[model samples]
Target: MQEISRVFDAERIQWASATASGHTVNSAEAYQATGVSDLLPRSPRQLVFVECDVLGLEPAEVCDHHNPGDPGYDRQPQEYLQGSSLGQVLSLLGKEPTHEQRIIAAADHCLTHAYRGECPGVDPAELADWRERSRAARFGLTHEEIQMRIRIATKALERAERIKVG
Candidate 1:
């Protein structure tokens, strides 16, 4: 556990296949294993903490967490998790502004891509293309594997100290 945590501490990107499991997906225990809780976003809300739910899964399954803050002021364990489906659960998230990356995404309003149907002016063909690209990129992921990778990526980005890939 200590060795793996060392790796997570050094790399904020995806976890290697050896260390992850369903139980540790969103728990503080996982964060502890990585030893990098201090670097997470300040938001009481964890949704915006996610830069991309682009991982091939339902929106509900993205890095979901449930952090019931402690009795007083100390918001221990955060209030979010990495894989959820309930709207009400989303509501309980921390009420803080998104971190910088999220702000950039919101400024672009990329979420609109998900519901482009509502935007009469946007081209339908464009939406189809986007979906295709996303599908192509996620070709290797099973429905469940997709959800799991997204959760780990989201949490690591939000809380891990540093992340890099080669």
Candidate 2:
């Protein structure tokens, strides 16, 4: 079991019985100093989205794992990102991804490193040599295409950052 610092006073939490999707589900309860009770989200997708939104990440950054166009698309969320601080927090909350969520993340891995040309390992000159031996396998793009995608993804990321900052 993993423990996390209390978002509120430790005394303010409890286990609450609930039902979700017609199935019995357990929920975490948080009580305010005033004695008001709140329940955390039960769905993994909603939990992840809330965390990503709170972190100011673009939807695509966290939710691009299941894109149909990715060459290596396998419908999982990017494994690497899920190991980050945000992901760790989610894990502590028992809001881990479902099988479909994992698949979505897997797809994002391809889009970020391959289609968007944002990965450090992507080398235009040696693409053919490493294409099949890499996570971005068979995701080779022409130098011009890579450059274009890099520019686009960068601009979009910049825009998202600006939005976050503002």
Candidate 3:
């Protein structure tokens, strides 16, 4: 979300997370949850539904990679299918992913073996550190702890050298 915002220079982009509740939430439900409508009067709104099915919305408005029949899923290169939502969003924005982004994509896709053997140029220690930070961020860290992890991860990524992967 931050990367996308930076790329587009968006003045404001409100965000809200909805519980899966054993199934993905519809776009309308996600929109209502944002409460952005109440904050702003009736106006044109661009709602981007990531990793969720769209309801009363066009396929182009979504960024899901789970439904095989969905355009979002069909559009991705086979190798990138594992990268999922992040890959889809980056592709949708026509952005060339950075080295850190590539690492994240690979990690998120569970390509541990590939990074360990196939991409030998990537340092295992750095990758492990990143994975630890990522897991901490996702699993129950307080807001402050998550922020600290992000800062540490960001610095580590900045210092990392880019390496080619087959």
* Clash pairs detected, candidate 3: none
| Clash number for candidate 1 | 13
Could you tell me the lDDT of residue 159 within candidate 2? 83
Model 2's lDDT to the true fold? Answer: 0.35
Name the candidate that leads on TM-score.
3
Candidate 3 stretches with Cα past 4 Å from truth are: 1-47, 70-78, 81-83, 112-125, 138-166
Judge candidate 2 at residue 163 and give its lDDT: 35
| Residue lDDT tens for model 1, 1-166 | 2222333355443332211233223433433232222333444433222212222222232322233331211211111111121212223333222232222222123335323443223344554444444544559645565556667998988996775888
Ranking by lDDT: 3, 2, 1
Candidate 2 matches the true fold with a TM-score of: 0.20
Candidate 1 structure lDDT? 0.33
Tell me the TM-score of each prediction against the true structure.
0.22, 0.20, 0.48
Model 2 Cα lDDT, one tens digit per residue, 84-130: 33234345455655443333232334434433443333333344323
Worst 10 residues of 3 by lDDT: 32-41
> How would the candidate models be sorted by TM-score, starting from the highest?
3, 1, 2
Which stretch of 10 consecutive residues in model 1 shows the poorest summed lDDT? 76-85
